[model samples]
Target: MAGLFRRTMDYLYLACVVVGTTALVLISAVIPYAVFTRYVLNSAASWPEPLAILLTIVLTFIGAAAAYRLNLHMNVAYFANKLPPAGRRLLDLLVQLLMAVIALFMIIWGERLVEVTWHNTIADFPFLSVGITYLPIPIGGFCLLLFIIERIFLGLPPDPITHGSEAPSFD
Candidate 1:
């Protein structure tokens, strides 16, 4: 069961990385086309900018969840590092609990946001529902929540890239 859970999480992390990277690549492609069409071709393409904006939403949320799993998310530990071992452990758990709260908030509010915009169509891409574009929010939040659970229950999974060989944190 434990192995299965870990394997599932590993796959989820991989998916997040792949999807986020693809979104970023698409955004890169989209923005250049937007620029070229507007400045060089003498006509701005409306779809490119909106498409890039949508892709950016995917990149930000999914990429952040992946980063959090790998402990690559921004973390300031100045005060945490100063605590005694026991105090540090407590603080670490506190941080995790707080992260869980944040994840829940994202899920709840993100869903409401999606529902509220469900019927709205993007101006440039009328066939695409605005709510469909907002899916990454709740999806990313769920991924984050899963990763947090894994960290709390199983300890951090071995970093896929580093295999847990990161430089030791302060004792």
Candidate 2:
């Protein structure tokens, strides 16, 4: 059961990566078109800028959750690395607890933010609610919380180095 759950989470992590990557790819495409339209065509495209902002929101929140799962985010672990094995383990736990607090903060506040702004819509995309744009914050928070649960029960995922030759995994 645990293995199954872990494997399922692997898929969840993949989803985060996919969403983030897609947003990045889209932003790349949209920005250049905006530049081309403004310079070459002598007409500015209003939609690109706002669309890019929305994509940025997706990339930031979703990519962060994925990065958290892999321990790939910026880590100034210099002090932690010097600790003995037992001390290091304790510190890791403390770090995870702190991360949990951050996750809960995001979930609660993000949801409230979404609710408060639900009626509002983006100017560029009038049909899209502002609340929908804010969904990524809470969704990413939930994903991170689940990853924390996995770590608490199953320990940290394997180092990317060992699995680089095989599937994508944390690698």
Candidate 3:
């Protein structure tokens, strides 16, 4: 059952990556086209700037979730590196819990923001709402919280190299 859950998470992370990449590409293309039209053709794409900003925000949040799944976030390990293996494990658990708490905070605050913006719409973008623009924060925080919880349940340790052990001699 645990293995199945892990596999499902892996697939979800992969899907997030694929979707975020596609959105990034589309945003890049659209923004550039808009710029070109405005400068060269004396025409403007009214929605490009707003849409590009929205796409960028969504891509960032989704990409962050993918990174969380991959355990690619940065950490301050200079002190933890000096600890023994068991100590290292404890420290990792502590950090994971802290991260989960922080994520929860973001989720709560983000939801509040969304609620406040629920009745508001973006002035520059007619089709998009403020809620849509602010939705990614809570979603990303939720993903991050889940990832950290999984790590805690799986007893994941910080990277071994985070200990700053010397590399094996090549000679």
Better of 1 and 3 by lDDT: 1
Q: Residue 6's C-alpha lDDT in candidate 2?
A: 87
- lDDT digits (tens) for residues 55-90 of candidate 1: 999999999999999899889999999999999889
Clashes, model 1: 0
Ranking by lDDT: 2, 1, 3
Tens-digit lDDT string for candidate 3 (1-171): 767766666676777788689879989899889989899989887888878888888898878877776677666789999999999999888888888888998799999998999878888875667987888889888877877777778644334343335666558
Two-way TM-score contest, 2 vs 3, winner: 2
Clashing pairs in 3: none
Give lDDT: candidate 2, residue 52: 94
User: How many clashing residue pairs are found in candidate 2?
Assistant: 0
Cα lDDT tens digits for candidate 2, 29-122? 9999999999999999999999999999999998999999988999899999999999999999999999999999989999999999999998
The lDDT leader among the candidates is 2
Estimate candidate 3's alpha-carbon lDDT, on a 0 to 1 scale: 0.79
Q: Estimate each model's TM-score.
A: 0.92, 0.92, 0.81
